[model samples]
Target: MLTSLYVRHFAVVEEAEIGFGPGMTVVSGETGAGKSLLVDALLLLSGARADSGMVRAGCERAELAAEFDLSALPEAREWLRQEALDEDETCRLRRVIRSEGSSRAWINGRPASLAQLGELAGRLIEIHGQHEHQALLSRSHQLALLDAYAGHAELVQRVRRLAQEGRALETQIRALQGEEDHASHLALRRHELTELERWALAPDALAELEARQRRLANAGRLAEGIAHLGELLDGEGELALRRTLARAQGELTRLVALDARLEPWRELIDGAAIAVDEAADALRRYLDEVDLDPARLAEAEEHLARLHELARRHRRPVDELGERANELRTELEALEQALAGLDARLAERDRLRRDYALAAAELGASRRAAAARLAADVSALMAELGMPGGRFEVMLETHGEDTSLDLLGRERCEFLVSANPGQPPRPLRKVASGGELARISLAIEVATLGKDSVGTMVFDEVDSGIGGAVAEVVGQKLRALGSRRQVLCVTHLPQVAAQGHTHLKVSKENVGGQTRTVITRLDEAGRAEELARMLGGLEITAETRAHARQMLERAQAD
Candidate 1:
């Protein structure tokens, strides 16, 4: 239930903090006095789109806040708990709209996205605008309302899910059946796989092959260079490294005999002579092992050329040839599997269709049962709302077996009505008058009350085309609904205003050369004066005041 609403710098409303109670609250004001501003504020708090024009003329932003009691709304409380936004048994929703057309929302003082605000607000309040009844002319809207009244959310959702699954299966079957040349495609893939497998494309094998090719290509240069190195290190010439070291060793050994410090130099020359002999031995082994055959070199070069040609033919880098081969093998495998499973998929599609049919039939039966009860209840309400001899019917047009299935099940729903006696019922859009439409819309809402879990319901002048006894009946129905859930109504009829458990009057005034809207909760005396004003227009006669008081007293007594 809504506890209070605070609005500041919103349109003509400079500032207003209005307290609300548990029952139906009616707001009344003269035309152009901004009576609907309260409803607008609630809409904004409920995550409606905001506009810069909603800000007061000289203000930079508009602020709107609504507080709700969650003790009776466990669903809303649980939602808050899930979102980590709960604060005790109360929920506060605040929205700020800047003059630049940007808006921000908060839930329980924590920043929130507009979608989060909308989701939480939907569980807390349901708002019906003045033009809501106009939607009744649409068959789709009528179907939705019927479903809502029937509480068929779960059943309808299940039927929709089954139908979607069946459609998806059909699409897959069609795609597989369309591939008529799978045999040829598979053969081509197999040929490509064979070609890729013929090459040594694995990373390790390719590295070893390239290394062998490099060694074969440079064998002659390597053998010649090593031989020259061997000659430089240990040849029999006088300038050879080993020969030069031998002479140095002899001279150093003689000098060492003369002075012991010379012995370390003689040892260094001997170590150098040994290193040169080892170098010469290694070169001799390398020259013997090196492959200097022209035939092997040609073979290595021709093999590398073949690998490059394979890379070019496949339009892939040499390194990626292995990956390409794997991809082709996988595709060939999948194509073969798809060809073999075509019959199985077709069978599955048939199974889904059968399942969808059964579920749709069950949903249809539920709708038929709910439609009868809803039509009876709405018809009874029509008579009480002054449409004597009126009848309402929910017509279900079942589709044929050949018709394609959709999310709306196998039947279309439409509302039919007869507003006068001795007349056959016709479609609501074609037969009902404006006043009749409004009353019928109200009857549907009244019939569907308590079906929704929302704690509060707001009607923004839904009583537009109604008056007199019918207006009073509308007010009574709304008031009765308030007994079960909180209701807020914006109305111009005294009959409706008098039926409120609480009354609020909206009035516009000019202060300091600026226009502002004010809302005040009405006491018994204040309610009488406001009702009298609504009843008598610009002049409030003594008789009108008495009549207004009596109406208020009578409505409350009822």
Candidate 2:
């Protein structure tokens, strides 16, 4: 609840601090007394746009601060916990408006933004006025109100969670479909990979084929060189080196036999003769085997050309062609497996959508029942507020069209109203008069109070229309509402003002030709005088005072 409010340097307010409690507090005075100015300051503190005219005439700036006790609001406390903004059990909201038309806002004494303050203020208080009939015009607000009234916020939350899950699953299905959509790419990749696999090129195979081509290109020259060497080494009739070495070996043996010291030369001669004979035999065999075959050379060149062509076709280094082929094969197989997985995922996504639909259906059913009960409750309260024959209705409509193999689950709900019997209930915007609408708005507030968690409800001229009994009933409702939270009502009706737990009289006073607004708490006699003044105009007669005292006594007794 709002524990305190301080206004400094505001229009006609100068400086004032008001203490609040957990019950109805009434602010009353004649016209132009700055009573509503207090409400204006509070609205600004709650994140309303600021106006430079609100600053005191002689001051450079205006400041407003309001305190809230959050010990009882667990939701707000948890939010504060998540944001790390809590300080003990209190939250302070402040706003400063400068004469230059600039404004600053704060929460918990730290610099803050208007949006932050507004978000927190929404949970802390609800200010209802004539302009908020737009909320009645909104379908979302209607559903929220009825959901709050029927105590089905939990189900609404469940449905929201399921909706989120369903959307996530649907996103995955879309991504899978995107992969499946590239069918042409998949087919082309498979065909290319299969062709590469069939070739099974080996590393350096191109270089090996090139080397064979070189060997074939020089085969005739190689064979001719070997045949000429064989002829010189004894393949033809000539004195070969091997025959000359053999004759020299026999002469050395004769000389070594004559001289015993010459035995090393005999051993050398024998080894040389053996080496010469082996060389002659190898030369004869070389001449026999050396022959050029152009057919085989052509075969080798063709093979090399084929290898080079394949390397060109694949657009890779010949050595890397093998690795590229292996990689392509792996990818093609993985894509084939991924397609199967995509199908499975899409099927699972379909099942998830069905589950979401079932959950939403259940949620819609609960909301339907809840809307009826809420309409009944608010209608009853409205009747007690003196609109005896008013009719209230809640309507729901479903969506159509199937998407992604599943139907979407959703519906629109509207609040309908009729001011009197024999009249058909239409949309709230079309059917309700200003007074009836204000009262209806209050009844809805009252119906949703326990679940709303707002610490204060400010009624701006809620007692504007109707009189006598209806006014008392409005006062009683405000009082009962105040039992759970604080309520501040601005009113001219003495009956409504008299019922306040604390009565404040706002008046305009002048000192030294400067007009200012003043507020004072009225005691019992003061209350009577005020009520008598309300009832009897400017004359305060003895009978009028008696009647005022009696009215006070009865009001206080209740």
Candidate 3:
């Protein structure tokens, strides 16, 4: 439940800290005294849109805060725990609106987004504006209210989920069936695969083939070069390296016999002659192996040209042709598998349809049961709220079996009403007067009591278009609802104001030449004076004061 609200530089409210208690609390004041400012403040704290105009004239920003006790609100506590914003059993929500049209929010002193604040606020309080009856006219809103009253959250969510899944499955099925030309696609892929396979070459094999081509292409040059090298190393001419080295070695041997130091030089010349002989042998072996084969070279060049052409056609590197062929093979396999799996997918779609039908059927049945109870309860409350013969009904119109899946179940919900006896119940939006709509809306709200999990319910002038006994009944209904949950009502009706377990008086004052709105919690004497002011209009007489006191006493006695 809401524990307190703090506002500073917010609109005409310069600064105010008001503590709230459980049960019905009525806020009353003269018109234009900013009676609904409290409600507006709570709305802003709940993440409503804010603007620079909401700030006071001399202030840079508007600050609003609300505190809640979550001892009985497990949902709120769990939400706090999930968000890591839990601070014992109390939660504080703060919002700052700058004069520049930017705003910031916090939950338990932790910076939070507007969406987060709204989400948490939803679990803490529910504010019903004076114009809420306007929304109640919408068929969708009516259905939502019925669902809430029926405690069909889990069931409605299930039906919606099944319907969504079924629609998604239907979309998949359509996409699969839309592939009517799959056979042609498969044939094209197979033809491409076959072409790729025909010229597929491993990377290493391609490298080796290119090397062989280079070697074969230069065979004549290589043989000529090797023959020249052999002549230079071991030819029979006197100038050849081998003969020169041998003659040098003979001379060195003759010198070595004269001096032992010359023996090492003679051994070095012998090693040179042996190295020249080894070179000549190696050149002879290489020249013997050299082949001038144009046919093999031509074959390798044509193969490479074809591979490059294929790479150009496929927009891939020549080395990646093998990988491309593998990819095409996999695609062909998938095409075959997709064709084989079509029947299975169709079967699964059927299963989803069946599941959706079952869930929607159950939802429809529950709605019918809940609708009966809700209509009866609202009708009974309508009689007590000064509509003697009025009747309320929840009409469900079922859709055809072939209709597309709907997230709101298989039927359309419409609220119908009859304001007079012997009259047929008509759609609420078309027939009910504004006062009647307010009463009926209140009746529905009262009928659905205890169904909402929100701990606090705020009604901003919910008694807008009714008066006298009807207003009294409205107050009683709110007071009764407050017994189970906290309720705050902003009203001008004396009867309604007198019904509050606590009363707050809103008044405007000019302080320091600046207009400000002030809210004061009323003691018994203060309550009587405020009520008398509401009952007596601009002036309060002794009789009006006595009447106000008696009204408060009577409402409390009840």
Best by lDDT: 3
Model 3: how far residue 371 lies from native, Å: 2.3
User: What TM-score quantifies how close candidate 1 is to the native fold?
Assistant: 0.70
- Higher-TM-score candidate of 2 and 3: 3
Q: What is the Å distance of residue 478 in model 2 from its true position?
A: 1.3
Expressed as tens digits, the lDDT of each residue in 484-526 for candidate 2 is 7788888877778878888888898897988777888888989
The number of clashing residue pairs in each candidate reads 0, 0, 0
- Candidate 3 on 1-558: residue-level lDDT in tens? 999999999889999999999999999988999988898888888778889999998899999999999998998999999999999999999999999999999999999999999889878987776443244677876788888898879999998887888888787677667877988888888888888888768999889878988889899889989888888888977788998898898888888888999887787888888888988998899899887878888988888888889899889999999999999999788768867888987887788778878888888899999999999999999988878899999999987574477888888889999977888999987863655766676688789985657799887886776789988998999898889889999998998888899999999999889899999999999999998988896777999999999999999999
Candidate lDDT values, in order: 0.85, 0.76, 0.86
lDDT of 1 at 346: 83
Tens digits of per-residue lDDT, candidate 1, 479-535, equal: 988888898999999998988999999999989999899898889999999988988
Clashing pairs in 2: none
Alpha-carbon RMSD, candidate 1: 6.1
Displacement of residue 490 (Cα, Å) in model 2 is 1.3
Judging by lDDT, tell me the better candidate of 2 and 3. 3
